[model samples]
Target: MLKEKGLFGNIGVQVVIAMCVGTLVGAMMGQSASMFAPLGSIFIHLIKMLVIPLVAVAIISGAAGLGSSQSAGKVGLSTLGFFGLTSAVAVALALFMGVVFQPGVGVDMTGVEGMFSNVYADKGEMPTFWATVLGMIPTNVFQSLNEANILQILVFCLFFGIAVSKLEKERRDPLINGVNAIVDAMVWMINVVMKVAPLGVFGLMADAVGTFGFSALMVVFKLFVVYVVAILIYGFIFYPAMIKAFSKTSPLKFLSAMKKPQAVALSTASSMATLPVTMEVCEEELGVKNSTASFVLPLGATINMSGNAIYYGLVAIFFAQMFNVELGMGAYIAIIVTSTLGAVGQAGVPGPSFLVVAVLLAAGIPIEGLPLLFALDRIFDMIRTALNITGDAACAVIVDNMINDGPQETPEPESSHHA
Candidate 1:
């Protein structure tokens, strides 16, 4: 018989209750609830502290385990291809939804003028494509880590990991073991920090709702609806279809196994934090091989951001529509490409909403609209993080099927011995 889960045992239940209570408190107390903002801020900071090391070590360890450069290259290419394809499709779907729904219509923009002006005043020039690519190559690795530039850190880890894998066993074994130890340590830290997730989420929700109240929510309610609809379609429809089409896996079975990891993702709102759970579910529940799960899931955590792609596309178009900026064919295409690429480069950390800045700048949408979106970001972050992990697990199944020729078959039960 399965053991019953206690109140504290289910983090999802705790977080949901916290969100509801926080919203109620915020609605009741208004600005006074803003006092709780620091609680959430501290939680976010704790999560961010792990991002750089966790990403670097995860990637390094995963790459080092690929056994050969050729195998690494093949898996790397296939993994990136899957991420890129799914992200592009997600962005396209979001764009289609944005155009069909037109979520920004009939919206009030009265108090937002000050925010727009402030952000506009501080807006820097958008970087060129080549310059942006060049920026990924870090001049100083330490500086990149200090600044938490994920793309730069990713580039460094890729090179460092590949180089390490080339070393003879004598030299490589120690480095590999050391990196694995660090990855394990970081995961342990994640578990410890996640213990306070309920309180953290409570503070975040309270502050968000308290400060903005219902007005902000009403203004963007349509956009929120559109975003939720898109997420549902992608998570329920797109992912399952892909899994079945590629691997003949039962969609119901896959989603059933994903429950725990999805819960963790929804509460933490950070893919990096949810990585360990995702890996566990993929291997133990879904029966994905460890070698494939280890390599694909970590890389997917870094790059496979289907949910972010959708959000970026939707937000860029929403802002464009709100600003009455007419987008040409080229502009729409740019939105698709830029949003997909932006999601690719986005760090798997909390507060990924900031990465939408690049999407807006690329599409010539005003940066001032970001503050408006920021108000609703936390709720969306939960949804998107869940989708991100789902996509990761699904990709693992597909890749495993391709590389390993589906799951290994279990031997028939041995005849009972009748001594």
Candidate 2:
């Protein structure tokens, strides 16, 4: 294992500096800043190349370790329950903020109107319950791997991991060791890939700022401000409070340790790409067990999207207010349910989200102004992603506390080594 020894060597510091520098360059260069896209692209590609394999092996090792424990069933159920509870709470918070702030009230859409169309009216209708369930079932797992279908891969890995846990001790030990060895290899690969993370962050920020421009912010700046407020509430205050109340973890300590992974999430704007960094930090700094962190973190990245839930809830309010559509009791319920479901349905990848469209339709809001938001989606996505990974880590810490018997996070003061 290798560690960044000092402040300048610290990846987090380097990335933060790169982000600031990139933003200035992008603002100056405008769209021409896109030349930096390749630096970001290669960085993202390196991270993505490891995601599928890392996820599969991590889940296998994690689930297998848990399956050997008596609390396996409890941990799984508790994890799901925690995610659902937090997501519902996130939507409620967003709705409250949207109403109080009134960000979309009396906004002019003079020029952006032409950008809207019913073309996307047929937009991605979320899958049916059975469809989503069946989709998780990989008919051909190898094909799923080739296609990089994360949900399907997760399902197969959990099942295979459990089965491995049932194996005779001699046989199981070697397989688990092999799977864990693969995870270590991934850590090494991530360490190597992260050498360029500062450059990647710079390129990504420059390209996004240059291409999207900040002009769009004027129209939705209110919504954007409210959005950030809601995200910070969830990410910083709510998550840390959860850790303090439910686990032995010090809120301040956990928050401080999480900076590196959150930085990665902010820059990449994709939880999947940030998964490796999140896992390392959880295991190394947060003291979450490999067994617990591996299973919970990967699963959290895949399905627990409290951050996206906030985005959906707020977006619904933005449109409903701008169009003067009054939301009824049922409409509020629909927003809450639809937003939570839609958020979970989404893969933890980066792009302009269409899930908000479904949320709007569910609450009978206008969809015309969606494209306007799309222009600034990357900025919104980056902030929310940082929040999303925080929730994932929070869940891992709390759930690990609930079922594990004793302290798992031994303080390691002598070693500055990292994953």
Candidate 3:
């Protein structure tokens, strides 16, 4: 009976109800609700535990499966290009928000220790750009895997897959085929993990509701509205204009097709978990080729972070504002640059990224301001996850267009979305 309603139907329903109930009960009791908080934290950890392996194998396997390593570079570059474009826009929007809203005025909060306490600027004897590039070459594959350094793994897979694809049919085919088989197995394991995502999400929701209740909800509501407005305007209007200029597909049609996956992304609040559905929507619904979808979607899911980028900037500015931290022009630039880079560097889980953000705050910045938002992170996470998926879809369309000779004939007219 429960299965018939769907995993989303059951788990999503439970989570919302849990949040509402927890919030109501906590409010009545005149205390922060602790019940269900542990469950939620555990669920978040479980989802996080799956992220490292899932990201590494998914990228490697996705890259190698693209037929030749040469094409893999093409896909990787396209993916990076998409990420670069969206991230830049995100930072710009954040800066604009900071300036227009003047979030950094007359705020005060006490800084915390043992957390992110410094800016990501002027590290002593920093490596050169070329050196940083070279450093991506993993010395030990297993070491990279253990550390879950996605960029390094992606680098290895692109070149290695290209080499395998360039070999004689007998040798290359067997090797490439073997890697695909392994990737498939890993994907299956990821699916098994996702089966419990609702439980995780539910626990996360319950804890957040119990702890923060009404006041946190109000803050989250404000943040959500602001961020969603930014993402929607940029994703739907600005991005579509860019797409129309560069690609043949209608942007509205493109976005309409992605709605189902986006909905799932919003509900789950995990880009990686929503990937399988997003990939399907791109291929079956939007007519993106399998190679394009596989190559673009996984990479996007891992690194392409429009929502995270914007959140970093806005949150940083917001925190600085709350703490009455005066960020001069140089400091503002540093915030934008560091936040953008950190989005790439701290690419695994939401929690770890905060640690990176904490570093930004520790540098005589506004670390104390961050805790003000912690109570509302989960709510913002849902919207950000949706925006992340939207960026993925947009990239898929752009890259698919770039690779194909031109546009294919349009598909039959029908309602574009599917659940």
**Backbone clashes in model 1:** 0
Question: Using Cα atoms with residue i matched to residue i, what is each candidate's TM-score against the true structure?
Answer: 0.88, 0.94, 0.78
Off by over 4 Å in 2: 405-419
Clashes of each: 0, 0, 11
For residue 9, give model 3's deviation from the true position in Å: 5.0
Cα lDDT listed for each candidate: 0.80, 0.86, 0.63
- lDDT digits (tens) for residues 322-406 of candidate 1: 9888888888888888888878877677773666877777777777777777777877888998999999999989877776663
Q: Candidate 1: RMSD over Cα atoms?
A: 5.4
Q: Tens digit of lDDT per residue, candidate 3, span 246-317?
A: 678888888787766665576567787677667767777678866667667777776777777778777766
The runs of at least 3 residues in candidate 1 whose Cα sits more than 4 Å from the true structure, single-residue gaps closed, are 1-4, 110-115, 121-126, 406-419
Worst 10 residues of 1 by lDDT: 410-419
Candidate 1 versus the native: TM-score? Answer: 0.88
Error of 2 at 330 (Å): 1.5
Model 2 lDDT per residue over 204-260, tens place: 889878987777678898999999999988878899999999999999999998888
Steric clash pairs (candidate 2): none
